[model samples]
Target: MSIYIFDGTMTGLLSCIFRAFQFKEFDVQVSTDANVQTGLFAEVIDVASNDEHAQRVWQGLKLKASDSAFKQFYYAFLSEQQQAFQHCFNFAIYVFQQQRDVSKNYGHADVLGMSQWAKQVGREKHRMEAFVRFKKCQDGLFISLVSPDFNVLPIIERHFKARYQDQRWLIYDEKRNFGIYYDLHKVHQVQMDAGAIDRQTASGHSQSFCIELDDEEVLYDQLWKDYFRSVNIEARRNMKLHVQYVPRRYWRYMNEKTL
Candidate 1:
């Protein structure tokens, strides 16, 4: 058995996949940041990130799996589940051989786990698309923060870019510690702790905005609260149904409606 340690980036995982092909060994384990103790009986290999290798893996996936399946695979990778890594590896190899839709195939335990995790992560991604609320900054950049259950920072870029074509904005996932920055011209990944952009100045932009609440914004918020209180029917309140539809974790980010 051989153990391979990767840098834990998407590219690093792709590089490990390439090395796996070269080694041709069974009983392999993929890990990140964990050191392997040297022993006379085992071999340890370190894989380096290679864009070419990542692109090759991507190309093969594009051919063997549908676009949706590939997206599920990506989400499974971002799930941060240790066991999920091997499951992804096994699923990739299976797709290469089966050449059919194996997403629903629950014949294997690992496949079933990956399918469940993928579905969960994908659902969160869609919910974020619908529920994201951005706060406009002084520089006209819209910003919002979320701590998602999965690494959904990568999945939100396209939706915001297409929907807000003429705006500069950022939607940060505090859970994953990363964000997507869309500067109107293009969208790119950005490190969260790099710098600070004031969340209050409305400088050069003139479109309807959604911004973070501050002391000055209390009036608008109170108006919303008043509207919510006035419209609610106390007799129709169903706590169970409301909690079932919107989990408690998301309540902090919601406006007056769900509070």
Candidate 2:
């Protein structure tokens, strides 16, 4: 038995996949920076991230597997579950060895596992599109914050870009402490320290944030609340159904939820 430790990047996982196939390491388990497990009879191997090697593996998969299968593998990786790395690896093994479409092969545990995770990731991706509420900044930037279960910003950005192409926007993941910014032309990823941001926006700071919604923004907020209040039918109100769909975890980012 063998264990592979990777840097937790997709490239590192792909590089580990390359080594797994090259060395015929069938009885193998993969671990990322976040999850490393031990086995009594396992030999540990540290895998380096190699972009070229990873790209080769990806290109091979492009030829051998369905487009949806790659998404499943990617979504499984984003799952960040303890066994997700190994699940992705086993799915790859089936694809490489079988050289046929095995996406519906529920008889294989790994295939089923990847599909389940992919479904979860896809659900979150769609939910993000529905739940995201952006605040307009003083400098004309639209800022939204979220802490999704999976890394869904990658998938959700496409929708925002397509819908609001003329606007500058930033989607920040408070948990991840990184954001995706979209200018008129392209999207860029940015990183920030939570402590630094807190200090910068502290009471003594020159400018305020979060609380800095100007008068116009405050009016917009009121307008939204008033609209919802006018349309809300007390007789039809269902708190259970509302919470079931929107979820309490995401309520902080919603505008009308504040009302």
Best by lDDT: 2
For model 1, the stretches where C-alpha displacement exceeds 4 angstroms are 35-42, 97-104, 194-216, 257-259
lDDT of each: 0.71, 0.80
> Where does model 2 exceed 4 Å of error?
33-37, 196-212
Shift in Å, residue 171, candidate 2: 0.4
For candidate 2, write residues 1-259 as lDDT tens digits. 9888888788998998899888999788787643555768778899899999999998987877788877888888887775887888888888889856876687899988888888998999999898888777778887776779988888887899999999998888877788999999999998866544331233231222443454587788779879988999999989999899988876666667673
TM-score for every candidate vs. truth?
A: 0.79, 0.91
Root-mean-square deviation of each candidate, in angstroms?
5.8, 3.7
